[model samples]
Target: MRRRNLTLAALAAGGTLAMLPGAAAWSAEGSYPDKPLRLIVGFAPGGGADALTRIIAEGLSKQLGQQVIVENRPGADGVLAAQATSSAKPDGYTLLMGTNTAMVAAPTLRPTPPYDPFKAFTPISSAGQFSMFLVVPASLPAKSVNELLAMVAAKPGAYNSASSNSASELAMLQLLGERKVVNARYKGDMQAMTDLLGGQIHMMFTTGTLAPGFVKEGRIRALATLLPQRSALLPDVPTGGELGLGKLTITPWAGFFGPPGLPQAITDKLSQELQNTLKRPDVHAQLVQQGFEGYGMSPVKFAEFFRAQYEAFGATVRQHNVKFE
Candidate 1:
């Protein structure tokens, strides 16, 4: 009887041991992200992307009841962060704050991209969108698109429009190709803006966040915005859509992504938490203050949106014959 009892006890213990892994998996699913979450930004501190990520991270941390940290790994026009995120483990703890430049534009601009934008990462959600503005020196004669077009056409290669290597410049080049405008290219937006202010470059297509101060101080004049409607911050300026150039809409967008093959349960949890964070009033206000229009969509929806954007930008690149080193 003692021997029989010992055998039964051993069987019971073995059964419980067999179930431990399954039970732990269930527990992880139930409580999800009982650990810290890190969000990687491709730009350095003080930029628009950093500011927006910090605001979102705070709200997300509050929602998840876990510490959410924003890590800046700014380099390669956001490629560094994207590559890091791509190589990271497919765990919910690590996320990349993807920019249009790094995810969509860089693939086309680079001669040989390090990673495939679509294949390397899982799309989480879009944080927001902001329009790019056409800014020129205040002393320039042209006041509108038509006037600028006529001036450029009359002089042919006399006026130049500068832009950074990201989507902003690509969009500007596309619009110019569509309108047949001519000019030069610069290494980055800041350099282009410097030349624009110095009367060396005629104009530039830049984000509202970058151009607002100059526009406010009258150092540069904002001719048109590249969004569907006018911005609340700059109500007086007309959008490219309102000016019969709706195709010129080139809004800068930011979003969250994780390493590829992340578990579905983790992805769902992160998506729900992100949606909740974006809904916060304070988060919305902070994003707006940084010139970002708050927008959040489901992971599937965001994936569709991302693909559409890539195709649209790809078309623009092909039409304009844009190539970068």
Candidate 2:
């Protein structure tokens, strides 16, 4: 009778274990992404974010032996795509090709951002960084950032600045520097570039891709890059720090993030594959042609970099009192 009782007790415990939730499906190395994965981009097709995501996704697909699709959910400075990513299951099937604007600036620019940048996601690897430059109409005589600022200081509100985005707004505010400069806001880059080219707006902050082509064609001039160090992509243009404008630095980056709670194993695997993909000569050359330098970081390192950047951008955002309307 005692032996029978012991047998029944053991069977009961075994049955309970078998019936417990996820007990049958709790492998740490469970086959992940048996199906195709989705990479969400917060911009329209053919734009920088979309193009970059597709490039990375193509390589990722080859590495993983499964298709990694690029899906565009463009809106709200990447807020829509971020919301989608934050709400996805942490199973590593859905990922975000997030940008500095989507992750860092979104929270600061809006009263209630869709998702918290630091909490809602897990940083994987940084894709690349884009360099921003101070651009002026070709007709302007200011040959350097210092010369241009001196000109703005003298004329004050006489010269107008075309602020195409929030980052540009903050940098332009710093450029104003205890002085007056009329800030003309625009919803997109092309609109502002039109006015600058038409001689209506005298100065603007632009990215490497847009500024260099125009500067080379003699339509506009690049005074200084917003980076602290000069970009190899445009060696002739001095850095803002080198030009004594260190306070106006803005180094925008593109990176990957999975929803919070993503398995560490999956994150590690993805990060490794991504680093390998970025190092490929073909991939590196293509990204460089798109005005990007491949910058891949491991999960832990990317988290540290993300937090540091958050602190830096927060300080700048607070100082500028920048808000989107």
- Among these predicted structures, which one has the highest TM-score? 2
Q: Once superposed on the true structure, which residue ranges of model 2 sit more than 4 Å away at CA?
A: 1-33
> Measured by TM-score, how close is model 1 to the native structure?
0.85
Cα distance off (Å), candidate 2, residue 250: 2.4
lDDT of 2 by residue, 1-325 (tens): 9999999999899788767775534443357658899999999999876877888888889888899999999988898999899899988889999887888888866777666788899999888776677889989999887788788788767888987677787777877776678888997777888899999999988776677778778899888877657766678998777766667655677889999988787888789888988987778777777777677899999998888777777777787676677
lDDT of 1 by residue, 1-325 (tens): 9999999999898778658765644555677788899899999998778988999999999999999999999988899999889999997889999988899888866778778888999998888776578888998988898888778777766677776656777767756764555556676567778888899878888776778888888989888887667777678889877788767635678889999987676777788889889999999888778787767788999999888888888887777777765
Query: Which lDDT value does model 1 have at 16?
Result: 88
Q: Give the TM-score comparing model 2 with the true structure, all chains together.
A: 0.86
Tell me the whole-model lDDT of each prediction, alpha carbons only.
0.81, 0.81
- Provide TM-scores for the models: 0.85, 0.86
